[model samples]
Target: MRKTPARTRSTSRSRAAVVAVAIAAIGGTTLVGSPASAAPSGDTTQFKGVNWADPRDNYADDPVVLSGLSTSDTYAQTYAKASRVISAFRANLGANTVRLPINPYTVNGPYWKSYRGVIDAATAHGFKVIVSYWEGTGARKDGFIDDPATYWPMWNTVVKAYKGNSRVYFEPMNEPHGYTDTEWADLAVKWLGTYPSVPRNRVFVSGAGYNDHVTSVCADPRLKGTYLSLHHYGFWKEYATYDQWVSDLKERIGNCASRTVADEFGAPMTTGLDYNKATPDNNSINFIQADTDTFRQLKMGSVYWPGLRTDDTYSLQKLIGNAARPWLATTNQSGADRLAWSWGRGKPVSP
Candidate 1:
């Protein structure tokens, strides 16, 4: 599903206060630390993951509170709740990685301490975490960094906290549809230069144009070592055959499968779509089948758009049991089967 336009809310803060918090949070680490050793080539397939998103689809002017998490909770409380949710993701979906959304409001505000719980719980459980920056809502949600002043400081705080952790990866931005391809590449170059301490392999450079394609970013020599993130949805096409979908996706990827991961691709899971059987007339079914088949054939890693979201029809898993200690139930077994197949497990379906 396509992202809904972000709703507006004010997030003004004292610049000096934000900086002070960042320095204290970093514990004296330099804003730009010395460059780390070169990163070895990575295997994208190791990232069998799902996105744990806010009920608002991770687009919020305020702090992004993920499903099953509450901002009112203390750090320890958030950690405990997150542990249960992360465990549910693994048990229900076989996920080993989780992609999370972060914004200045969450990282540079009072919520930072508590938000760390989500990251900590995921990593403690041996799940790789992809922390991506999401832009603000309403007028500020124009596919651009709302403010670089806050943006740089936000990254400083996050990089300081997780730079040492190998399982925690950083994605500079979600989907930069505002800039031209060349401009986006340049910005990514700047991000790499600013944080030489982050291993290249641990960074995910989003594909340009609402993250609809990766070939442009992949072709840039400056972005060579970082993994590229791609977002594809069935809504992008009104209707297409299985082979047509395959061709469309490949054209966006070009020769970059080795360094590409479809981190945001999903379809209607709760709609009772039978992805296991051929459904040429059903766009959602065709899209899911084609994308999963292509991913498996290419040996590429893919994270579903959302493993859990409150009200999205495309959510692969739904909350169940006690709210305090939440667990998940798969909304559609066939969708789960398709996800498993994409991850190199489960039986393949005929096209």
Candidate 2:
């Protein structure tokens, strides 16, 4: 998710504090600092992950087929390209998980038939895939869910398609910006009820306010089995010190580390910054280090944003000339190094 105005982040933080205080005043346990349920093996806080985008971009909602994959091709044929990319992820970054953004409208339409191939290919390659909804223009224009009529059905189709696949995870919505903490929790519960057959562990419930803050979501007992989805970008607070960033990140997790995943976090790949250096010269590097350190200390997993994208600055991989699949790009050596170091050389754990 793109960074919003500074005021928005400040406001969200303020609101989170207020809600936290209210919960405390009522003699309710905040669940803050509580021990989190253990994550899947190999899926510890150090599990390396990346976000792979469709070649068409525009949030993966475009009606046209992506370059490597053909519209008329069989599932096997379309998945060949994905397999190549997944291989690169393993060989180059030691990444085990990939978070994919799905256009809500495309699921039940022509897109669904072909998209299933991508998910199947990722799982076949031993990678955990997270599929989340992104409302085309709504995502950029308002970041809110404006229509349940279309939204609910899209998810219904998603659950039915991958409910039985353990490697495939369900993220109800990408960033529920319009809903209050309680409202998002309500919707998550509703979604859980809607697909009773899908285990709670397979669902990723996003934190409130652009999936930035999870204190409220963690406090909800009904969301127990589900992992918390969090998105943090260095640009969100361009000037924060490493110490401040670390503190803020921990605050955001709110004691739900074990069951939390930083599914979306990134920095500028073109900056040529050294992640190991703890200086103030590069906030992106600092952000990467802070998050890596925080997740490591807390034993939470993370997926870097944009493992591949057409012209994104934070993409870990860039498409080779005319090649549909992506290869590791050299531009973000520091970011790549940090991810590899965090992930280590061990086999990736299935989420």
Candidate 3:
């Protein structure tokens, strides 16, 4: 979910704001795991990642062209450009994973053949790729799949293309606030049934309702082996103490921190907020500090929102150099410090 005047995305609460499955056997094939015997909670810390979104916040009626790549580029051209940008992410942020957005328009169109370069380049660099679906703009942005006819075929194409690649991970929907909890769970179960060959560990089932909470999805027995993706943003609240923010996050997670990955969480990076300091009166500062502290304490994985998005104040990295061969520079060192702190590196801040 993303909340900005430029783009209208999903919200966790009415106030505003931002922004996985299992396995089983069938038809004589022996499944690897069972729901009765819980799979060990994965090491979420392994995913040190950031989102690389389209300039339009990934809500487009047409193909979504990422910040540095164009729709007209060939596969080889995209791969070459993505290689430089991906390397810049690692050089500037020590990142090893990237979360990217996909929509029916992008996947079911001609640009898909070219877009494969982004995923291919990331995996070639040994980076984990999390491919997620985003809905269209205008009336189509109602927190639901725009059209099932296009939706299933999109997933079919995506799953068939990437299921065999160990470095690629799939997230069914970005934020399913349109459906009730039960409805969403049923949908997830259906996804799992459709793609049994993809390991549950590689699937990221979103939290119900704007991806604000994961307790319901974590409690679902059928989704045992999967990872859970969560999105939290400072704009969700007007103000909060560090401890209050910590408690708020913990309540949403319950005891499922091990299986949870805060794939999207951020404050305004270009605004000069000092996340390293203890600013009790500042909402963004307090939210960033508390969330990073909680994530570090729980050893949960986190991916900063918009590692590189054009003109987004919350984008941690900014594009530099030519459009064909782009690179990134950190927007705020203090904000970068908080991200590193959440990832279990960098100097610790005193509470």
> Cα lDDT of model 3 overall?
0.84
Question: In candidate 3, what are the lDDT values of residues 252-300, reduced to their tens digit?
Answer: 8989899999989987888788888887899989898889989988999
Clashes of 2: 1
Model 3: residues >4 Å from true position, as ranges? 5-42
Q: For each candidate in the order shown, give its overall lDDT on alpha carbons.
A: 0.84, 0.69, 0.84
lDDT (C-alpha) at residue 37 in model 2: 45
Error of 3 at 4 (Å): 2.2
**TM-score of candidate 1 against the unseen true structure:** 0.90
- In model 1, which regions exceed 4 Å deviation? 5-43
1-351 in candidate 2: lDDT tens per residue?
Answer: 643222133324323324434333323332222222433443356346888765545344454344355666667666877788778877777788988876655675776777678788889998998888775553343445535566777787878778788889888888776557886687777677667777777778999878888889879987777788898878777587778889989989877877788888888776466675666766776778778777766777889877876566677776664455544545676667777655542222111
Locate the minimum summed-lDDT window of 10 residues in model 3. Answer: 18-27
TM-score of 2: 0.82
Screening candidate 1 with a backbone cut-off below 3 angstroms (N, C-alpha, C), the clashing residue pairs are none
On TM-score, the leading prediction is 3
Q: Write the per-residue lDDT of candidate 1 for residues 306-349, one digit (tens) a residue.
A: 78888888889999999888889999999999999999999988
TM-score of 3: 0.91
